[model samples]
Target: MSLEVLQVSKQYGTQLAVDQVSFSARPGQVLGFLGPNGAGKSTTMKVAAGYILPDAGDVLIDGISILTHPIEASRQIGYLPEHNPLYMEMYVVEFLLFVAGLYQLHGAEARQRVAGVIHDCGLEKEQHKRIGALSKGYRQRVGLAKALVHDPKVIILDEPTTGLDPNQLVEIRALIRKVSQYKTVILSTHIMQEVEAVCDEVVIIHEGKLVAQDSLKALKQNTTEVVFVLETQEEMQSKWFDDLLGLAKCHLISPTTIRLEAKEVFLLRTELMQVLNSHGLTLISLRQEERSLEHVFYELTAPRYNV
Candidate 1:
């Protein structure tokens, strides 16, 4: 694993912002850190970056505990904070150079590093403009450029896509996806669609506690699957009674529609027809509904844990 967090928690007075959350990530994988606003996603990322100390537990990078070696851990992790802060008075290229200098690069090497990121992050045109003069999308690119200039192995981005236009969102997402080829990327976002767009696995926190950690597909599989609709006709429920008999799960909606699995649809309709005919029920319609990530996100994060 490139990174590991063991039982981490953060408390501000009586309020616990993060509680015993643990997970791992390696190069070539993007982990989505998902939760609602104020759900400790930012706190967790800050702790991982060594910007804030956890009240308990450990954060490690490549087997080295960050608490004991903040500099080494920081050298390995590139963090773009939730706000994407940049000095409004500084030009994009100048800011990149400053960040590069912090990483100990100098002379030609520093200039090359800054230039590489300017192109890599699509900040070429805005490179000479003061950050305060750039549009929100361009400014976000500068924030990302600074994070990438040092070539860190672990990238931690908090709501990296916020305030971006649709085209900019796609562009930035592509950039992140490309970088995942050689580094571990941890992204925090409430946009469920972005999770599907780039992340390989997802770790969800709710009320300062870990609630889910799994592949998106795996999470969906574990959630209950039920189709709900109006109850169909009585006569439809009686036909093919024996043939349509064994369904593992089925749900009836209001008195005219039926919701069922695709495999069971035909059999269910036949059997339901028989049952309906016997009981004077009439069938109106039937349909299929599959669960979505939005539903699963809500389900996992809905419960409150009073940490």
Candidate 2:
């Protein structure tokens, strides 16, 4: 199923949490919703999930408006909120079964789907344990299982990897990638690496406004300038790059690594070769970094964050 938010806006008392923000998600792809804290990502997802009504505009699930057809639209979405509300006293299996029942999945089908989801989410080892006993990572798995039990076409996740360890983070990222094959996954996060790791498309918000949205590859090279990481076999002084063609700035990131920024990457790369040859320095690696969301994010949202 496809999910589309059109000119959606929301307000809380005196603060405008979201202002005419719009974006989309398609099946078989992961669309990342990114923003600084309080940028209204959660608010937009909530409106799309039908948990709350928008002050203006609408959300459509497969062309079905969440506002006009709340029940039908909700039936098509599986949302895992930032906090991941779960009954701590309930066993993992029991909680999933309870959730399945809410959607009217009964008898053999409920049991089968619960079993399948447990296995899919890698919750088999901890299925019989109470939710309170599971660590945060496993708890997250259980929450994901809950979201999938209904077999919804669109899965909306809000900061699902917030507090995971590195190992758990990788596992969850893999699971997200695995699930997106047949489901429209809208993942909300502040971590740029997470977006780089799994997202096909990106939507960035800043101060409750939509700032940028595009394919991950397109957004990566969208900025006017590009950064290159130059590493040498021998440690070099920053002054060696002085008067380099259109070199905006240079910083020593490591003994053998220097980060360079320029308006035109081609010019910088060409001059870098000449400069290295002039210094008799053997270049280990000099390549344009593929990472872009970090630079794009801070550039667009710096006012709210860097203040």
Q: Candidate 2's error at 278, in angstroms?
A: 26
- What tens digits encode model 1's per-residue C-alpha lDDT throughout 1-307? 3989899999999999999999888889899999888889999999988899999999999988899988888898899998988999998888889989989999999999899989888888889999999988888888888888888889999999998889989988999998899999999998888899999999999898888899878877733344324355442221223344444433333224333433344454566556656666555654445677775786566542221
Alpha-carbon deviation at 98 in model 2, angstroms:
0.5
Clash counts per candidate, in order, are 28, 0
Using TM-score, give the best candidate's number. Answer: 2
In order of appearance, the predictions have TM-scores of: 0.80, 0.81
lDDT of 2 by residue, 15-120 (tens): 9999999888899999999888889989998898889999999999999998889999999999999999999999999999999999999999999999999999
lDDT score for candidate 2 against the true structure: 0.89
| TM accuracy, model 1 | 0.80
Give me candidate 2's TM-score against the actual structure: 0.81
Candidate with the greatest lDDT versus the true structure: 2
